[model samples]
Target chain A: MNKTGRPQDLPLSNPRADRVRDVAKLAGRPARLKRGHFLVEGPQAVREALKLHQERLAGGEPGVVTEVFASEACLDRYPEFEDLAEGTNARLATDEVLAAMADTVNPQGIIAVCRFVDVSLDTVLDAGPRLIAVLCQVRDPGNAGTVLRAADSAGADAVVLTASSVDIYNPKAVRSTAGSLFHLPVVLGADAAELAAACRARGIGILAADGYGSLNLDALQDENARRRLTGAGPASAFDLGAPTAWLFGNEAQGLSAGELDLADHRVAVPIYGAAESLNLGTAATVCLYASARSQQEPAHGETTHE
Target chain B: MNKTGRPQDLPLSNPRADRVRDVAKLAGRPARLKRGHFLVEGPQAVREALKLHQERLAGGEPGVVTEVFASEACLDRYPEFEDLAEGTNARLATDEVLAAMADTVNPQGIIAVCRFVDVSLDTVLDAGPRLIAVLCQVRDPGNAGTVLRAADSAGADAVVLTASSVDIYNPKAVRSTAGSLFHLPVVLGADAAELAAACRARGIGILAADGYGSLNLDALQDENARRRLTGAGPASAFDLGAPTAWLFGNEAQGLSAGELDLADHRVAVPIYGAAESLNLGTAATVCLYASARSQQEPAHGETTHE
Candidate 1:
């Protein structure tokens, strides 16, 4: 070990090494469950993982990034990694070794093996978060990851996935998130009816993103704006600015009827054109942004009703 | 030919038939280009194609669906196809033949051979369109199709793809569109420079979706709402309610320098959280929806300002 405890000297040159295969096994679910770690690929995701790891370490918490592997070229391209990898189990590996260890065809010369960062639904709810996004039986890894990314973009406090959802730690899902997986708290394998009940008890409203819902999302946003600007509008069906959790459904069939029944309101993103419905990611983005915008602190000096 | 003009029976069951080979070949680019036809798979897509074809045929114009193939099970599941595919060359095929002729592992027992529906850029521009989405160098077929579907959901008048973008007629692209391909006009192989000029000539403002852009999309929408409600806000940088064309760049690199320079403004969809930026489809959806909502006919009896 280096005297300064900064990772420097390991030269990992063999693609067929046991260590490399162990890292690569994170690509599958069984291996991930066995090791309690997942693959974070590409430069952007690896950077975020390292940042989170350093933050946790500073807080005297266990680090999130267990191991980081990079090539000299990658380190040169992204010099920040040198400092971020401080005290991390960082190794300089050949491109072949890095590729062999990563799930992606090209992991941008950097990959991180990160501890599973998901927290309990109780942990998320205890924070009194203003906004949360929940996925219900969403089967597509790409769609699940896209929603998670969109949730992060909207500044969602946490994202919850139902038990039937595709594994969030799936390699393709991680890549689709574009590093947002590290940006927000995540709750895995949540039970929707129980979660909805917990939210209601906490005074958090539940809204389902439904194609057949009677409540139009645009109407709610317009009303929120009207009340914000002129201090006058029709009585709102639901307060958009209030703490809320939005439930998004599967890509093809959308939310099941039971899932819809649990929400305080089933809100449909208005389709202005002839499209029957928006795709899952698109719908979730629009709905979350609607809540985000309305919940944003009033721009002027006016007092907020909330 | 049947006296009722309905597809009485084809009884086609040979998977090795030349007709099956020809249909299957449409999955490739060369065959599609040579015949000027694309494969439309899945029931929802085929129904939409059949509707468009019947509409054009009723208008004394050429039909869109040159051929339709379906199984009895599919027809039983989606009874509307029986009426929709009328007057077209519809035929019954066995599951094996249908599978052989399809691009998808399962074409859901229905597939259609459709003529390309993309229109000329001039046709779109001359239609006095209020809103359009232009994709520049977007290589992912799924990304391209998602944006197209989002544009349709937002009621965009048309969607334009720069020459460098993926071929919209590709099967994956068409599948991702979920039948929105037939919902709105598409202009393929457009030159971005010429398109910007054309839009300008038509009094349309061009906005590029850029991550580092100085303009915040949320701020613009806020100003738009203020102007609509209280009729007071800072002189807006740009009007969201005007005739506009939004330019979305590639998924990875985004719009090149030249593409960015062509826009009247580069508008960034606000990343309220730690996400660096929204993915291409998400960004395009938010941008298009903002324009669509702003350009919507004011619900109240407000007088016209445009």
Candidate 2:
């Protein structure tokens, strides 16, 4: 390959280089917090970080993405990355250097350094959010990331991770989010009780999703059906479309009795099969989409019932 | 710890033992194909294998579980495993031995050797199936496993993996299934075209889920909505509740044009938000649950609309 302009920078051949070591350390929670930055690995995540970074810089806000490192092949495959690197410290590195910096065995030939972009709970609520997903004490990184992606796909306004929840910056969690971390506001380390109180004050009814909840999601849908048949609008019943905050619990042990009590209505995704229950991520997706469908569809139409 | 009964047997301390080597080799495709056996790692998988083994034996079928190995801690944690070992060969091994024979860094102290449990496509279809999940060229083990779990949760009759799909017995996929592998019939390595034909011959409608499909899932729900409002009952339209087979495609390249042509209807899950699309597993879960809710609910009540 012919060497040109920016690609002529010496390839980072040393895995022990200080820059590589610093990026590698960001994989750990302590390192990420201490440095106030996190590593975004793989092509998808790096692309998303750059896209969001450009948006923030355009809005005159501090850029979330500080640096972009790519191999010649990666930059060639995604020429847009070069443009995305315009305002950032973009560097050309050997594949080995990128691997060393990433927590995964393979970093897909690109990685980016991004500052922590978690918004404050006050900021998330001040936007007057209607649909939100609050993960309470969810410890699995993969589950956390999947919920974030699902929430983002469901067009949720925000996602709040309670203090006891898994760190959203965990590389596994970030990888699982599939770049959704950059799509919406994600609040970390918030107190669950205080957040519940805040949501209630803002008129966002909290619905706790648990296996043993008093409200069955099916019954809620039935209520929607009856109301629609009776000529009531989507706003008349407490179905999935209501402005609400869904609180999902831990993987093994679900929301506690006290946690369940914090919600306006405790809801369970109805299980019709022999399988005991849906996993946290799957259940949360179902709940969020239910609400999304309710809120998006017009009253007395093909999509109104559920 | 008291070394009594079978616990007194010497631990298989050698990681390089011939048995350990053979078990470890099963993780690869060639070894599994040649030996007609695969490794089921972790407690959840092993427990499911043994439980299903017991059920098969009771049903007069050959036992699928051939052998089981566990650490003293794992055996003690689940005393039921002791009872489950009645007809199968069980051995106590050191944790290192278990780890060496397993695929993951930690196998949670137990692993089971199981015969390939895939049934013939005809066998799956002959049972008059109402619901099925078909994966076409899906290469990710985790996504494959998750779809199996979701399908099981939704009470599907069976799951069919196209010839190009990932192996269901992959240890990572088995782990992701969370024991759902034993809960339902998983038919692997079937020709996609033939599977579609079999589904058609059985009067099962195939709904292909794609991002750019002509039919919207919400519109399918709307079809159900119009039917219910008009008192046509749940059986009147191309709604989610109809007896159908849901075909999902590869993670990266979705169903090809040729593949999509095989389905009765190409359906797209509505994207209500800005996110590009839902991940394969999450989208499959939503599709499966939609059908489940449709099939399981009474024809005239609260769950009727969805």
Provide the TM-score for each candidate, comma-separated: 0.95, 0.90
Could you tell me the lDDT of residue A50 within candidate 1? 91
Candidate No. with top lDDT: 1
Show model 1 residue runs off by greater than 4 Å: A1-11, A301-306, B1-6, B301-306
- Those runs of model 2 whose alpha carbons end farther than 4 Å from true positions after fitting are A1-16, A229-237, A299-306, B1-16, B232-237, B298-306
Q: Model 1 chain B: which ten-residue window has the lowest total lDDT?
A: B297-306
Tens digit per residue, CA lDDT, model 2, A111-229: 89999989999999999987999999999999999999999988999999998899999999999999999999999998888999998888888999988887778667655654654
Error of 2 at B136 (Å): 1.2
Which candidate comes out best when scored by TM-score? Answer: 1
Error of 1 at B187 (Å): 0.3
lDDT of 2 at B134: 94
DockQ scores for all the models shown? Answer: 0.65, 0.47
Q: Please give, for residues A1-306, the per-residue lDDT of candidate 1 as tens digits.
A: 232333467669999999999999999999999999999998999999999999999999999999999887888787788888888988888899999998879998899999999999999999999999999999999999999999999999999999989999999999999999999999999999999999999999999999899998887887777777776767789988899999999888999999999999999998989898899999999999999988884755164233
Worst 10 residues of 2 chain B by lDDT: B297-306
